[model samples]
Target: MTFQPLEQALHEAIDWMLRLEHLPASDPAHLAFEHWHAHCAENRLAWQRVNGVLDSALANLQGLPGQAQVASRALRALANPPRRQLLGKGLALLLLGAGSVSVLNRLAPVADLLADARTATGERKTLQLADGSRLSLNARSAADIRFDTQQRRVVLRAGDLQVQVEPDLARPLIVATAHGEVRALGTRFMVRQESERCLVSVQQHSVLLSTADGSARRVEAGQAFAFDRRGSMAVAPSMRTRDDWVHGRIEARDEPLGELVEALRPYYGGLLRISPQAAQVRVFGTFLVDDIERTLASLGETLPIRVDTLGFWLTRIDVK
Candidate 1:
């Protein structure tokens, strides 16, 4: 299912809500909002959904003194031009609260919703394909499966995957990302799609890694490779710990703190921000992916860093 239209509708509904918040029923914008709400069924549904979330959030705040004033202040802050870029982030923190399913729905990528297989935040899923191959998806991951008489393909939309291929010379298994493809020559391997590159780790046998530019390299078992559309390079062997997420843990071998934070983001329900200096801090240890707070607390104890958490909505890490 494609969520593009619905996503657009939801965004428009939010815009309308913000606009109408300070406008009277007699305002010209009210007429425009009415037209937009009546434009289509999707608009109506999005409006209802957005209002439902806001109502729930308001109810949650009802116990506080001057609840109406608090909400009004938050909405007005969101309307500021300087803070416009933070509209989503601010709302997620101040109004939506933490771990709101509505927030997740708004933040999730359209491609993820349309994927043939996907896992939600902090969730892992395993699948046995029609060809007897086993596939494991990491947190916040998505992929599309395409199988035919000719080839077996899994397109990684985002995040990481580990697969144990069923031997079939007749139909080669290939994992593709925006950067390139990893053709499994043997069985077990892992693939991760990063912002600017794709990472491949071979666990059982060798796989042929190819870039979008037609460059190719053979990555042997126990080796890891990283590549973008332009070129490829060998990553540190220890980096193969990329698949460690499958075990609900991360084994950082003197890795940068930013890498560890990136790994933890998918598992975290709300915003997790780290300063550049803190991110550069070298980390070496094992951390649990499922328990973000505990892991972060452990890090804070061991590293020269400060961790500030605002309920469950946000956690900010900085160099101490």
Candidate 2:
């Protein structure tokens, strides 16, 4: 009913659009966005505005020289309650061309570019640390390493990693994520930073897992745990087979179509999308991460799904 809430929702919708553009359709963020979009009339209207702006400007965005600057100014103006007028102008300038969106997208991963260690999509790496430890990074992953006299710490910025910690009584090895820190006690483990939480799976020995709230728990070998900033809140049977991805293979045992798409996203160089109906399908197999097209073709052969390609950057799956 109030213009203020509509304006707020508009801003939030734009932010969510930026994030969801790259996230898997099955991510909790996507579900949360669906909830917000359906919350009320104002929210839906705000989302409509976002889509309308993009639809109106995407095709005519060629050679808009000063559009990026104009968009930036208009976006700043929208922050001060200049809702309708400024928002309209900002979206117009921002979506006017693919170039503007390209600029913004580049700026999105600035931190990863400056990270100590990073792997691009479909790329993997094995690093031998100075402390006789081994660190393997998965696709689309970034990490920052900091070693000192007191502690050996790794800050995971995005994606997943496997760490094999060598014995070191002098310094405690810790892997830190947004949710918490996992202190490895001479163990081999895996850590994945998801949108809503961090998942830690121990392969050998135990680790002292602590959340931002100071709550701690022991995750033993053959155990997997998920936690948020509040603390270690969940435990599941460790899936050692998951580590196969480090070797360029994806092992999906009756995984949902949406989840398989999520796992394949980092390996493929495109916007891979699955329709809601097709996402409900179940997939089981080991696919090669490096050969996304072959894997998709194989999936199409066995499942009742259609794989459509739009250039080299967009792939969509829907019920046949």
Candidate 3:
């Protein structure tokens, strides 16, 4: 219950922050500040996370030379978000004055109630939901969840996921990604929606994939497909094995090294680059996701591939 409230506050705060940060320190925002502050103290605290995110965002922008002038000029992004302070006051009332931590808990689920969360840069997570279902997240994944009176929705503002869903008429979990939207109807399936292409592969049960333009496709279990601005296509049957990555494993059945690299990009941080000539190399079989060093080592030994490490984290794969 406590968890639910915190998450609700978090979701609300994030939306407000986006609105505030996108705007300048204008008159209407300033005039609205007082009521906003009166709203709650938790709002103020919640905004801190946005500020924290901004600090890092600014630091990154600062390093980009010409970007310094443009971003510094936009430092006001933080100033106007003072609107968040309103949420902080209300939160304080609920947590402190009301002294009903139990009341709030019973009333709301606290933060981090979502079934899954994954970090960026060499991170992964496997989550088991309340319904005896499973969801796995790749690197840099995020979702704001709402399992309300009717449907369960996972709003994928970013990231990729594979879900094993159990039957539940009360609530069916749906994942919305950038390129397309997918909903599981009591099934085990994989959904990979990057900025451009969205891939859906059903291992068992079934799924429905729909694009922004309302192009709909029913993906049955065992078959895999990918879609983009060009439109969706049934991924070659040879590339349909979707269960291989469950235990940090990648399986390629006579797949081009180029295609393999593209598939692996989201799993790795920085870059997983392949040269034009190197992309021509074909790779086969499964590799352990747990052991990047050993996996790359095995590739070097088994295939005409060279693993060139310029610096600690920089690795380039080339045809030997």
Candidate 4:
């Protein structure tokens, strides 16, 4: 079975689960759900798969911190029409045994959905701004565009973006993140928001990288920089591979397996778990971002690791 069909079935099953959660047994929706479930074998399988995990998880919910709050928030979000789809995706991942409630909470794409521009998992998008600048978002990325007479800014809410400035001297183009801001001095550059730090790679001219603190640094063409809220510093120029995602590829040169897995997660639809020992293994290669299974197979062939997949929703990499 293809992953897409199963994924769609799971999503539909989740939608039905939410709708029927508070409804009475005689609710009209129950009959409709029964019809839908009987419509195909995949639907029956998906319903069973979801309920199997949900039943087990719910049995232990009391022992799990914040599970109740997470469930409440998910239900509340589902009640909001505009947020239903995004919340459904998050909830499906949660009930499918992806992670802890806290982890799933953080993985929820609420902020991404509210951004001016965003891309779904395994999807990429490019936008032509009002200022004639070009902004390209990597998979699962989100950014808000703000334009004014004084300045033009893109607030990157998540993931990575490559921006090509139109060069309006009247208003500088700045890309902001939790760590700091990248003021485009030249033409093009890329900024990635990581958990603890922000990464900037200049492809055209230069960018003025400023941290949340007062410090600033000039990142010239072909250079890369990384910073946290507290400080900033230059990184290896080889960090240019950071933009490889723009082309649906990951170019890893002696990169840690964990970092590579992190890059792959946004492109993969399911939860990808890696053991610490497997994560520390060094990798060097170019892999397609979209063909996750093929990439994993290649890694398994070349690296000392075991890749195990559970249906279409979970994959684990462990040291062999």
Candidate 5:
């Protein structure tokens, strides 16, 4: 998502335009939005390119109607409403659906129809990787998977990994992580390429985790754990399933506060400051990791702690 300075300025202006919704029309938000739009050739070019406002509106109305209804209603709104109301709602929707519209049309070579997915810092994602097998990448991670006849492979450009495998008679899927590699031969597993180590866990089928040094381990299902540059450790039942966070929940059996907070960081952005006062709090319930603000509110209710906002979506925990 590289952007030129003009593009960046345009993005900032778009934010102001959207924020105008909270102010009185007399405040001149629309006027400001227009002024910025006409600031220079570059500004206008950037404004024409940023169509995120439209993307958001369309995403919000995904199942209700297609883009045609939206286009017609927008024209209709411009025709029927007062100058103020029409500009307010119509401009917002117009901007939302129009993100990168011109840029996309011009840069046709760079279009991605695949809903590009992302993982935040310390955030991980586990998804069924086409072959009925599953792959999970650690926080600050990304991978593009494609399954073909020759082999099923995952190219892990960054982050730690843990995988669960479903075998196919054709070829065992291989994981290529930064540290090294792991090849599965009918196995259930977890593999994490931590800062220095590539941990591999085999839950049911067999998996071979061969390090760069030529050392290897064959792990089994229910026997779950990690491996790195140092060595392999005992597989614990507790580490067997940390897969729930992606689906919006984390069911813990007395996990530590630090671990819980680390698990919750990806669902929310910005600093999630956990005061040392909560360093040792033991959590043992299922948490809704999705609506992180609501999760924080829930934490405030269940524990003697308060979630105080520090803006920029930053939050801190204080003893209630």
Candidate 6:
């Protein structure tokens, strides 16, 4: 069928883009790419279509107020990965050709770039709001803070944040996400936005959580809760230990290898693949954020796993 042929072409186009995205202009790959691009009219058309989609997405992101510079830098980084390859790992292999458009839609790269405050991959930032409240963002996080006479609100567009509310009885402090809103009642809490739900962990005082459907609950201190548009779920006792990332490390406590790999993804500027067996293996340790390669090597040494590295932007974990 025509659909089958077009799908194959799209897959090929995606593969080609990934290969050439991080390659140097003078590399032999470019010569090969040029030949491939000019080989047939269909190939040319596919290339043009792919490029058009990326350009349009980039342009749309750049149009956001005060986001032009950040979006340009982010897009350029995606195009030309760094030689050290720190945090640019996820998109290349996972998002192939038209798939890139879908990834863009899900991640909302423009919204993150345009956020009032944002932290790049493997980077954390602390901000002091106008109301004297403290906001700490985790790596690869984005938040928009809007303060007016009516309320002090922070919209968590992506990732996680820890907020220490400054007591202001006149104006309530609220944190909003895709799932719902958490109203701070002189509380300190952390909100992490996962795929379909948001996790709210209250550390001090209590927070009033309201779902999209008008259901509400007061999450007290020492509790961790998750909620989506539908409603809030059961609450669990809070962890006595703090998030290790706050201390510039990742602490894995009998965690699946895949979970650790995902946690490390934001710090790696490469494509990483974990075999099914490798992902199922359990790991526990503290990995220094700055030494990701060493951490991976340690995994290979201690477990029945192999860490395979191919060039600056490719790594794979397979069963030994």
Listed per model in order, the count of residue pairs whose N, CA or C atoms clash below 3 Å is 0, 2, 25, 0, 28, 5
Stretches > 4 Å off in candidate 1 = 1-51, 54-102, 105-108, 238-241
**Which lDDT tens digits does candidate 1 get at residues 27-84?**
8988888899999988998788777675565565444455444443433443243223
Better of 1 and 3 by TM-score: 1
**Higher-lDDT candidate of 2 and 3:** 2
Residue 174, model 5, lDDT: 81
Q: What are the clashing pairs of model 4?
A: none
Best of the two (4, 6) by TM-score:
4
Candidate 4 structure lDDT: 0.77
**lDDT, candidate 5, at 263:** 64
Assess the local accuracy of residue 247 in candidate 3 as a C-alpha lDDT between 0 and 100.
65
For candidate 2, lDDT tens digit of each residue in 238-313? Answer: 2222677778888878767887888877766445789999999988878887777789888888999999976334
lDDT of each: 0.76, 0.72, 0.59, 0.77, 0.55, 0.72
For residues 1-320, could you state the per-residue lDDT of candidate 3 as single tens digits? Answer: 36555545555655565566556776576446546545776556555554454344445444445544444342232222222332232233333333322212211211222324533323466887666777777644556665666877776655567788878877777877667778888888777656678678888888888877768888898788887655578976543346565667777888887876665554442235678888888889887754455666687788898977542234689988
Residue 221 lDDT in candidate 6: 84
Q: For candidate 5, write residues 1-320 as lDDT tens digits.
A: 23466545655654564466468868777787778777777676655644444444435444434533443233223221222222333333244343333322111101112212224332356777777776665444555564788888776554445567777768778876666567888775555545565555555667776656567776665565465555556655442245554455777677666667766664453447887778467777888754567777788788777778753235787676
What TM-score against the true fold does each predicted structure earn? 0.69, 0.66, 0.60, 0.71, 0.57, 0.68
Ranking by TM-score: 4, 1, 6, 2, 3, 5
| lDDT (Cα, 0-100) at 147 in candidate 1 | 97
Q: TM-score: which is higher, 2 or 5? A: 2
Over 1-320, each residue of candidate 6 has an lDDT whose tens digit, in order, gives: 36455445555565677678768788998888888888776677667655555555555544456765675465455422331132123233232333443334332345677678876555667899999999998767889999999989999988878898999999989999999999999989889888989889888999999999999999888788889999988655322123556667878778788888987775564557999988999887788765667777888899889999864346899988
User: Which of 1 and 6 is ahead in TM-score?
Assistant: 1
